[model samples]
Target chain A: MENEGRRKFLGVCVAGATAAAAVAAGYPVFRYLAPRSGQGGAAKLVIPVGELKEGDAKFFEFAGSSAVLIKTQSGELVALSAVCTHLGCIVQWVKEKQQFLCPCHGGQFSTDGTVLGGPPPRPLAKIPLTVTEGNITIG
Target chain B: MIRKNTLAILLLASLAFLKPALAAPVEQPETVCIQCHGTLPDRLGAPVKLWRSSIHADNGISCNGCHGGDPKDAANAMTPQRGFLGAPKEKDIPGFCGRCHPGVYKDYLSSAHGRALGAGGPTCVTCHGNHQVVKASLALINEKSCTRCHSFDRARAIRDAMQQTEGYIDDISRRIADFQVSGVDTEKMGKSLFSVRNRFHTLFHDVDVARVKGESAAINKELGKLDAALKEIEQSHQKRRVAGGIAVGFMVLLALLFHLMKKSYD
Candidate 1:
C-alpha cells in the first residue's frame, strides 16, 4: 500500500508540471500562429509627388483604409479624412465643384475638408504629411 | 469510492486544459483599435456616431483593426479577456501607433509632453485617451489642453512675447535692405557697430533667447552713434561740394567781367 501511494503521488506531480508547461509555452505560440486580422502596426507608405496634380485628389491605402491626398491650386498639399463624417461613408472628390461628395447621404466637403453641406457634423480630419526627396508621404 | 475521487481529480485536470481552448476562441474587437472605434457601415449596420468626426474615423481605420480578436462576431459579441491574441500591452500603445503615424509620433516624442511620457511622464491615454479618441484639431484649439502641461502662466506669456518679437523682426527685415554703399567703410566703425548689425541679423533669424532678453537695446544704442557719425561724414561732403560750387561760380563771373572790359577797351 505504501509503495502504491508513493507512485500515485509522483504521477500527480508529473501531470501538474506538464499542465503548467503547456500553459506557459502554448500562449506565445498561439499568438504568433493566429491570423493577424486586426490592425497591428503602422506601415510606412511612399507616394511620388508627380502622381498628384494641382487641384486634384488621389486616394491611397494606409493602415488598411483609404487616405486622401489633395493638392490645392495654391500648391498646398493636404491630407484629409476620406471617410465621410456623417456615417462612415467614403467621400469622393467632385472635380467640377472642387469638393468631396458622399454618395450615401449627400454630404459635401470643401477641398480643405470642411463640411459644406449635408449631415456631416464636423470638418474632415487632417493627416500629418511629410515631403522627402520630392515624394509626399502621408501618415 | 476511491475510483470516484480519482475520477474527480482527472476531470478537473482535463477541464483546465479545455478552459484555454474555449477561451482562445473568444474574439476581442477592441484590441485592434488605437482609440475607441465602432463598426464600419459597409460591413455592419451598427452606428459609430461619435467616431464619425474623429481623426481615426477620417483615416479609414475601424475598431477591429487595432484591438484584434474577432471583429466579425457581431451576433455574440465577445468580452475582452486578459492575455488574448489581440490585446496590446499598455506600454506598447505609443510604439504601435508610431509604426505608421511616425511623424506625429516623432513630434510627440520630441515635444515636452512626449519627453515627459518617456521619462515617466503621462502616458498616451493621459492626453489623448484610450477610448473615445477624438480629432486632434479640436484638442489643439482648446487652450485648456495646453494649460494642463504648461500650468504656469508666466512661461506661456514669455513664449507669446518671444513669438511677437520674432514676427516684428521679420516685418522690419522685409522693409529694409542689408546692402551697404561702396564708399562706406563699415569695418572701421569698431565692434559696437558690428555688434548692432549682428544683433539685427539674429533678430531677423528669430533667435528667441536674444530677442526676449532685450539684448538688441545695447546694439541699437551703438547703431545710433554710428548713424550720427555717418551723418557727420555726409555733412562734411555736402559742405565741400557747396564750397567747390561757390569757387567755380566766382571764377566764371570774374572771367566774364575781364573779357567784357577788354572788349570795351579795344
Candidate 2:
C-alpha cells in the first residue's frame, strides 16, 4: 500500500513537471498568437485650426511615422508624410525654397508632395486631412 | 590517412557552395548589345564584362536602358532608327545622365564642375566613372581624386562637414539592420533611414559647406527621433530577455525538484 502511494506520488510529480515545461515553452507561443490591442493603424489626430499660419510649418508624429502640416504663403494647407521616399529619412521644410528637402540624400519635394528635385524616386506621401469645426483632423 | 584525404575533399567541395556567385550569376538580359558583342573581342566585350560588377548592372540597368536601343531586336539594335543613342559627347555627358538623375545633374551643372564643362573641367565621368560606375560615397571626394583638378581644401572641408552626420547615419543603419535580423518589424523605419541617408548623400553634389552645416542639424533631429524609437524597442527586448532568464531558472528548479522526488521514492 505504501509503495502504491509512492508510485502515485512520483507519477503526479512527473505529470506536474511535464505540464510546467509545456507552459514555460507554450506561454510565449500563446502570447505571440494572442490578438494585440491598441496596435492598429494610426489613430485619428485632432489639431486645433489656425495652429499653423500661412508660410508656417509644423512637424508632428502621426500614424507611427513623421508627418508635416504646412500652410503655404498663399494660405494653402498641405499635409504630407515627412518621410523621404528614396530611403525614408524625415525631410526638413526648406522655407525659402518652399519645398521639403531630404537631408539624407538631398531629395526635394514640393509642399504638395510632388518630386521637385533630388534622388527621391517618388514624391512625399500625402496624408488625407480635413478641417472640421476649428480643428484639423487626420487619421 | 584516408580520413584526412576525405576531410580535404569535403572542404574543397564545400567551398564551391560557399560562394554566392556560384549559386547564381547575374544574368545579362538577352539584349541585342549582349547578343552580338558578348563573345566579340576586347573592345566590344570588355565593357559588358566590366559592367557585371557595376551598381548599374546589379540594379538591372543594361546597355539598352542607357543607350536607348531596342533591347528586343538584335538587327535594329544599333541602328539609330530604333532609338539607339550610341554615346554622348563629353560636353553632353551631364544631360545624358541627367535624364534619370535630374537632381544630381542640376546640382552638378550649377557647381564649379558643371561651369567648367568642356573647358578641361571634370564631368560626370570624371568623378563617377562611366559604365563601371560604383555606388557614390564620401571616398569619391578624397584628396587623391579631387586634387587632380583643383585644391583639395574646399572638398576636404565639405567632407569634414558631412562626416559626423554620416557616422550617425551608419550607426543607426547598423542598429536598425540588427533589429531586422532579429525578426523585428523595422521595415518602415529602415525605409525612413534610407530616404534620409540618400537625401543627405545627394547634398555632396551641391558642394556647399554652409548648406551642409545647416542641413546636418535637421537631419540629426530626424535621426534623434528614430534613435528614440529604436531605444524603446531595445528596452522591451531587454525586459523579455530577463523574463526568459527567470523562466529558465524556474524550469531548472522544477527539474531539480523532480530529481529529488525520484530519489526519495528510490
Against the true structure, whose TM-score is highest? 2
Cα lDDT tens digits for candidate 2, A1-139: 7766776777787788789778878988998998778776678888887688778789999977889999899987888998878767777888888888765446779989999876678878888889889899887
Q: How much lDDT does each candidate structure score?
A: 0.57, 0.82
Per-residue lDDT tens digits for candidate 1, residues A24-92, read 458658968997765555576678999988889998766544569999887899998687665555677
lDDT tens per residue, model 1, B158-232: 445444434444433322212123233333343233223333432322214435457556545545555566667
- Name the runs in model 2 displaced over 4 angstroms: A1-61, A64-126, A133-136, B1-30, B180-183, B236-241
- Candidate 2 per-residue lDDT, tens place, B53-94, comes to 888887667897779988998878888898999889999998
Report the lDDT of model 1 for residue B11.
100
DockQ of 2: 0.25
TM-scores of the first chain across all predictions?
Answer: 0.69, 0.70
lDDT of 1 at B23: 38
